[model samples]
Target chain A: MLWEKEMRVPNTAVVDGKTYATVLGMVRDDRFIPLELVYKPKPGDNVVGIVTNVRHAGYSIELNLPYDGFISSKFTRVSFQQGDLIYGRVKFVDEVGNADITDAKRLPAGKIVDVPASKVPRIIGKKSSMLNVIRDGTGCSIFVGNNGYIWIGGKGNLPLALKTINFIVANAHKHGLTDKVAEYLNEHGGDVKVPPREEEKPPEEKSGLSEPAEETPEPAKEPETAEPSEPSEGEPVSEKEEKDAGSSEEEKQNPIMHSKSAGAAEESGEVKKKGIDIEEM
Target chain B: MEKPELIKDGKRLDGRTPKDLRPVKIEAGVLKEAQGSALVEWGGNKVLAGVYGPRECIPKHGADPYKAKLKIRYTMAPFCSKGEHSRSGPNRRSIEISKVIREAFEPVVLSSQFPRSQIEVYIEVVQAEGGTRVASLTAAAVALADAGIPMSDMVSAIAVGKINGQLVVDLGKDEDNYGESDVPMAVTHRDKQIVLMQMDGLLTREELAQNIDEAIEASEKVYELQADALKKSYEKEERGKLKL
Candidate 1:
């Protein structure tokens, strides 16, 4: 499960055209249901954290990863206690995965259930389809965190809502999970009418299809002459020959790509993006 | 002790051919307290490896700002070996083994991903045979993967030796006791990069090269077992549709 061929993609096991199960769980629609996850924060991630300490300038929040998150007072409006639950989007994540929280707000004293962070997507469903079902049926306002700490609020069916979350976490790998979750909620919810899955259509058909098709083809068109890893099959005009002849120009560009501080920043950003594709694919 | 016949008719004492490897069984997530744990039973050797962290490193001064530190402790239990009970705790042999194991994994474990933290691996040899070092190494690789640490590739280790002028793999107790040479090695699964290699006794340059090639080939089988154990940790039917 390391790679499809000889290509080495860091952090990820499956690459190129092959799909392999990297985590322990059921595989449905080529998507793995992770039994547990080693949580890693990405920028703009909505995370639920418990404030571990109130520092001078910020609060150190435990987002359940190896790294602790920080919420600076400049970004947060309310002062938080050592144990307060904060829900916020990750403003930035450092090279070490330590996150900075912004636009922070305190969640009410509702129950917080921890699910495997990787399963959060299944709980939220595709385009919030399953989330809408839980919200309507149980009448609880649920906040699904990318870091796996789910906050359930509202005076609605608290027990039922928690049960639904657990059910979804367990059966996240099963096919047609959204429909099954709706059926399970309706059966036990009693008189609470859960909406049918038909109401929500796959969001990809509307806009996702066109946008990616346009964006992806652009990069593939100009196969970069750089990194001539794959030797062309009997092609007379290989990029390697051209690059050899234009060694002077290549040397000139090398210093520009390396010397500039902004160029270094861009290079690091590209590396981060490359390594972060471990589980998402 | 008098020298026992290490090999008979080109087969080792255990009746295995020179290229034959000892039976290895690997199981992942054996310990509840550890973030990830694995147990490897290779021939007569029983090695258990447990992994914890990417959490804050203890003795804060040692924390690396750029990557996580790997602290691997390879130890044997008091009653692990046959005959007289060995003293418990980290002896010189165990400490050296621990250092080599850490070095083998350092290149693969994507430590830069979890900077300023520590990843600890504890390898406990519950039963000892001749090739416990490689067994512990194989077990530790699976344990780290079970903990969800991002490793570039899995490592597989094995012992190659020469007994009575004949090359052998996965030396048993008798062969190790009277063998001319023993070479324990670990290699990355995909590329076969030698991460760890330690030799004892004497061998010709050609024999050493042959032993290394044999060790690499044998390690591929070990990697298969490690991968199987990691996958089985999550694929258990009982765990399918987990309750609660």
Candidate 2:
């Protein structure tokens, strides 16, 4: 009873006729999983976190991670507060253990938000351009982390910023999103700068069993070749991907028909033309 | 009352062989509002699994400061079966099944990762034939994964039983009524660890081992379906094809 494929756990290699599970390195341990599924903090990566606990030493923050992180008073200029949202950098990952936050700043007057970890890049735009749009338009300073935690700070445009970011987070998967976000920003605040058109840069991360197929394939078929090798390597794997892709196309054509994205459907009930048949819980 | 002959020659009542399983289909992200959900149709059973939370524990007291807690509820809809609508709420049998379901998943979920938070699972048996528990467990596993909860493996379950003195795989409702022994087994595939096992009626040592082996084999197929459903979900989400 051995699973050859998933047995990355050296701990599970049979010893004395017993299987002992191993907690492999959280990073690069289960290479099969997309990077979004595993949490690994790199030095200087921006992070947004909520203060889950306030200690005499400092505050423990939640980055939507398994472990609460500590932002030590070592570098804090202001007093730490509980339940407050903080934005900072991963200054150092004790790759030996948990990473410590440095240059931490509290965001007092704004909302802390979330998107699926996988969609963080989409919200951050092609290269922080999307994030910059939301920031400049709403006059909010936004920080997005690999964990999908977002800290949005602003007074004049706090509400607008939250709405815009929420929209982007909710509909991050849709195309023509940069235009949509820019349009919404301009309509709400005549002063906010709206970019005419955004350059859609397919990320450089699309190597290996990467997302080039699903992420950019909708608009262009050129990326299709990048994934053919993947499809051929494991025929069954590609077959499932094809079936899912087919079903997704079916849903897009008839969104109101059945099978809506859970995030979009959960946002509001009034969006439906038939309206009010299904009440929000 | 004449007993239904569960198997004739090699085929069962549904024309399935002794080792044949009921057809199973799974769809992930079936419910809105729930972080993750899935619907599974196996044989005549329709089960929906919904996952919510990893948020603050309600009642403010169910929190475990160190590890995320799991609450698994299994309910059989009142009209799930013929002629009789079950009363809503947790019955004794449902409670026991719920407990077992919780234990079945507790080992697989990376609950400790989200301390003091609770991830809840709601398994609604829209219809039940035989092996509703197994079907629901299968669906729950997918729903948990669909929710993007970290896990070592997805647990899959199937029931293999002795019907008309013949060991069979995936007993149907009719066969269950007349079956001499029924065993439901769940294993976390990556680990091949049996997380849940329950037996009803009787089996000798040798028969138990043999049937357990059959259950293990059947579970592998179940795992394939579960994995397929989960992968389909992420792929669909990736393509922005998800309606949400």
DockQ of 1: 0.28
Q: Give fnat (model 1).
A: 0.19
Tens-place lDDT digits, model 1, residues A1-281 = 42244322212343244333333333212222334446667555678889999999999998877768999988777999988987887777776667898878898888777766656766776556777788887888887777878888897898888888877764443334565567787789623354433433221111111112232212232222222222111111111222222233224323322321110000012122222221211
Which 10 residues in a row give candidate 1 chain B its minimum summed lDDT? B235-244
Question: Considering summed lDDT, which 10 consecutive residues are worst modelled in model 2 chain A?
Answer: A260-269
User: How many steric overlaps are in each model, in order?
Assistant: 0, 9
State each candidate's chain A TM-score.
Answer: 0.63, 0.53
Winning candidate number (lDDT)? 1
Candidate 2: C-alpha RMSD after superposition: 12.4
lDDT of each: 0.68, 0.64
Question: Model 1: runs farther than 4 Å from truth?
Answer: A1-10, A13-37, A133-141, A153-174, A182-195, A199-281, B83-87, B238-244
What is residue B54's positional error in candidate 1, in angstroms?
1.5
Tell me each candidate's i-RMS in Å.
10.3, 14.1
Top of the candidates by DockQ: 1
